[model samples]
Target: MDNLAAEQATDWRIDWQAPWLAALRELGQQAHGLVQAGATVASGLQYVKQAHGLLPGWQFVDQQQLPVGQAYEAFICNQRCIPTRNNLHDFFNGLIWLHWPNLKQQLNALQAGEIESQGVGAQRGRLRDSITVLDENGGLLLAPQALCDALREKRWQDLFVHQRELWAQAQFLPIGHALLEKLVQPRKAITAHVICVPMVQAPAMCTVEAADAWLSEQLRSASCNLVNKPYLPIPVLGIPGWCLQNQNFSFYDDSLVFRASRTA
Candidate 1:
């Protein structure tokens, strides 16, 4: 389907009982505030991970090869990831540093061995709602109270009604098929930097246009010989290699940044 048509069909109707239905608005506001404060992109994401754990499906991995730091676990069924526990912890970690600067030093001292990295089992309370929303093909069509119960009790593992509907409609079109296939693909994640931003500094960010320009220029100036080229071309023909259309970038408050990893 065309972009306009797809958007029209993409209902923003809230399922009232969705776990985040109440806090979604506030999340938006807080994210915006962080952006306006000149927080870097990484910082904003860290903030969200803390405020709404696992909801956005983010995961954190440290670049270093320490067994504990290298591969932190996350739940990314299909192509979506909920969010990183490390980052959520980092939000509080940063706070502790603010109150007692020495605490950061103490933590850093144990960075290699002292920090214990482990997986947080998907919280049953939150997962219940997610599974419900994504499971029942007709779950979303049910009464708000019924839906609320499913979400509250963590009973959302059934076929998500909305996703099922999307899959059905997508089956008829090649493009839809391709998109759905991509969405369903098993996730392959990598370790990348997590730039942390505080809630206080996420508002007065560079305009999208300005950031785009800046990022493009940064890419253009990179030494082509360097294996790590900054920008990639979007999968479109007849476009210059330098066109900054290949990747996706977003903002949370004023803190918006992109992931650059050892692989890239």
Candidate 2:
């Protein structure tokens, strides 16, 4: 299915008892207003560029205020993105900008470079396509290198079973509703583009406060290359404690939200 059809099919409707649900709902409400106002996804992006809020290293600006050029090229050049009432696609894009502006800018930079070099084509190549796919429907895990190593290697006992404390130190920020939806009924496709942020400072024992603090720090720290080249995506189900439906430390394993990446 295309982006819009899939978005229509998606349950962007959040009914969570999560701590971060308020923020998610706030963004949803903002984007929902546009949709309710009879906005189409594509045109909806054009409408919300009226802000001047400073987010980390970037500032929100209208595309009309930017230099004249191809639409995508102009957006990239100005280091800007739009929020659309259009489908969950751009709405989620806007949500990401609200939640993680620095990363959104980074992704836009990469996309701009592609458009600049490739003459703003109607289509995208693998790198650009992969990046777009990732932005639209990716989940991110932020943890130190060692914890990541164990998770990647499926060292479940060491990571979640024996030393469960190590597993809690990480952050799970799902990028797309589709990713979360897929978690309810997981398919390999939903597991396709997992993004990792290597935070050496993350504590061994993850607390809600520490995770929040670390994410805040990441948000402020000047943009970094959050993903690697060729994008080594991880299996969403394979997140150590995430899919292990058994006794010992079953908070994640037994939870219905196995696919829910808690992106605060």
Best by lDDT: 2
lDDT of each: 0.26, 0.51
Per-residue lDDT tens digits for candidate 2, residues 1-264, read 246644563544544433223345554555555555555543433344333242444433333445455565346446544523334544555555666554566566767776778866767776677666667666566776776665555454455556656556666666654554454454433354554656664444244334334544553462333433333455555455454433345543533433333431
Model 2 per-residue lDDT at 46:
35
Q: How close is candidate 1 to the true structure, as a TM-score?
A: 0.19
The global Cα lDDT (0 to 1) of model 2 is 0.51
C-alpha positional error of residue 135 in candidate 1 after TM-score superposition, expressed in Å: 11
* Residue runs of model 1 more than 4 Å from their true location after superposition: 1-22, 45-264
